[model samples]
Target: MKKRIVIFGSFGKVGEAIDRDLKINTNYEIIAPSKYTEEKSKYWSRNNCDYDILNFKEIKKILINLKPNIIINCAAFTNVDLCEEQKAECWKLNTDFVEMLARATAVTNSHLIQFSTDYIFDGLGGPYSEQASPNPINFYGKSKLAAENAIKSIDCKFSIIRTNFLFGYSRIGKKTFVDYVLDNLSQSKPIKVVDSLYSNPILTSDIAKGVRKVIKEAYLGVINFAGNDYVSRYDIAREIAKLQNLDTNLIEKIGINDVEFLANRPIKAGLKNQKALLDLNLKFQNLENSLLEYLTQLKISKESIKEISKNKN
Candidate 1:
């Protein structure tokens, strides 16, 4: 019999990519949970994978019943501002749920795969390594860091993957960095992006594939999985415009503090993929190439029209 894997937040971007990739390439049975209503069920369901509505308590019951050998957690509270406002809830989902999952995984003798973020670092420097000390400037980062610690504190075998600036398809909201910038540019609206903030914009599919590779190789411990290239928010916008044949002049660069934000942001969020590359022997595409592929997949020909059509369809 093939091994069974239980994926949390399987309806989200990375989750969907993982579900699709595994279903097509592996013999492992993938089970996911939906938190939507009946009329909204099709919104969450994709590619005929087994799915059911579940809460945290219900999730535990499902895990016990299924007895999966591997558990990949793609669920997270990623809204930076909301995390600051709902610190307790963020802790509940980001930190507490991880602890619960770790304990359950330990009980079942299952391997755990948890997603983390580069926001754990304060972005003091460029291209941070796995060994860099994390000093998060916001509640969201703190919650994820706490969760990472919780997973490490447990006695179960696990892989903590730290990534940033993710873009991909989802059953949920559709505002990505590329979409936001491209949309603003196409409308001839002057856009201001932080020149200080920097990180690799990782494709959701790449992250899913990296996680799968880690599982297949039976790798353990913390790993930094991200794009091979480092880029600033302003640079990303400029590149998106360039790729889609939009006017790059519309993407005006501004200081980090210039943009009003509810939560504090790190100055540089890029991660070194050497560890992941060495361990998994994985090669990540550069930012330009990755953006091109993403644009092509969405069937975007021009910058201005891409966001509207992509979101609407």
Candidate 2:
């Protein structure tokens, strides 16, 4: 019998990619999205999900019914400024909901894999290894760190994947760094690209591959998985433009502090991929190669749109 896998936040880029990978690999039975729809679920889960993650009772009940051997949680309030302003919601989802999952997983003995971020660090010095001490400067980072702490405290088997700069082409209409660059440049809009903050952003599909390996290996621990290249945010945009042949003139170079933000950001906050490489044996796609793949997807997307339009006419 195949091990049953349940994925939450299946609509997001990471979740969608994982879902597709699992289906393609045919290693596990995947269940995506909570069964409850808007009318059937509660206020919070109304259109979002079927069950409230904070409610241990509901979480427990759901786990008992599903009986999944693996649970991959991709849900989170990721907007830094928004998380700072909405502290209550951020803590509830990022930290509290994860706590409930960790506790519930203890009962079912389900292996939980949770996605995390580089924001857990203060960006003092990086290309940080897995053992680096965490000192989050903002509420979002604090909440994510709290979630990691909660999972660690629990007895359940879990792997909190700490990744950075997630990039990918999405059929689900999720926005990415490439999207931001293309959309702005197409409209002839000038955009500010931060030069100070740096990270080794992993491709979403590559992250999905890493996830598959983790499940196959049954690894239970926190791991830092990201790209091989370490570059600044501004350079990321600059690279995107060069790959897509977009106008480089419109891209502006600015420091981290130049842009006003509600929450503090980490400069030089890139994750070291040595652990993932050694353990998972996953060699990540280089920045240029990954960005180039996005170009191919863009061509297909354009052709698909035109075909649909022609059919309608």
Candidate 3:
């Protein structure tokens, strides 16, 4: 019998990747909270899921009925600065919601796969291991860390996948870090990127693959899944510019103290992916290769939109 996997936030970049992949595999059944309407599914990509994830009672009802074997939570309020301004909202979604999931999953004996961020650490030093201490500097990180703690405190079976600077193909409402750089550089618009902060930005598709591997192997504990290259955001922007043949001159470098952010940034929260590499036997593609694939996806997605428009006409 195939194992049932319910993906919360199935339309999200991470969720989309995982859903697309798992649908192809025979061993797992994929159920997203939202499914496309008959008309909309024809044009848009990933038009799925309706249940309000904010309502834990509703979530409880669903979990009790579905009793899925694996639950991948791709939902969260990830806006760093917005999280600072909206602390209560962040806590409700990030911490409170997750706490509910942990307890529910524990009762159901379902494995919960939760995505976390590198913001959990103080920027003093990194390329950090899984064992490194986490001292969250901002509200977003604090909320996520609280969620992590809640999961650990429960009797639930879980795998907390911690990563940073996630980049991937575009979704309708959500934009990846790569999207921000490509949009500005292509338009010759000036973009200010911080040079002080460093990270091994992982691709969402890769993270999805790691999630699959984790479920397959039943690996437990915190895994730091991220890109192989540890580099600054400014450099990553330049890499995108050079690859896309965009105007590198449009990119400007700034330090951490230069900007006025409501939330404090962890300057060097780069994670070491050796464990993921060894444990999952996964090779995170080099920067240029990943960017090239991203470009290919961009072209394909653009053409898909055009085709949808043409069909309508």
Cα lDDT for residue 205, candidate 3: 80
Candidate 2 residue runs with Cα over 4 Å from true position: 34-56, 305-313
Structural RMSD, model 2: 3.5
- Per-model CA lDDT versus the true structure: 0.81, 0.84, 0.85
Residue 184 CA error for candidate 1 (Å)?
2.3
Tens-place lDDT per residue, model 1, 95-118, is: 988888888888888889998999
Compared with the true structure, what per-residue lDDT tens digits does model 2 show for residues 78-136? 88999988999899889988888898788899999998899999999987899999999
TM-score for all models, in order of appearance: 0.90, 0.91, 0.92
Model 2, residue pairs in steric clash? none
**Steric clash pairs (candidate 1):** none
lDDT tens readout by residue for model 3, 4-86: 99887667778778877788898887878754555436434553345678878988888878899998888888889999889
lDDT value, residue 96 of candidate 2: 89
TM-score of 2: 0.91
The runs of at least 3 residues in candidate 1 whose Cα sits more than 4 Å from the true structure, single-residue gaps closed, are 38-40, 43-55, 171-173, 300-313
Best model per lDDT: 3
Between 2 and 3, whose lDDT is larger? Answer: 3
lDDT ranking from best candidate downward: 3, 2, 1
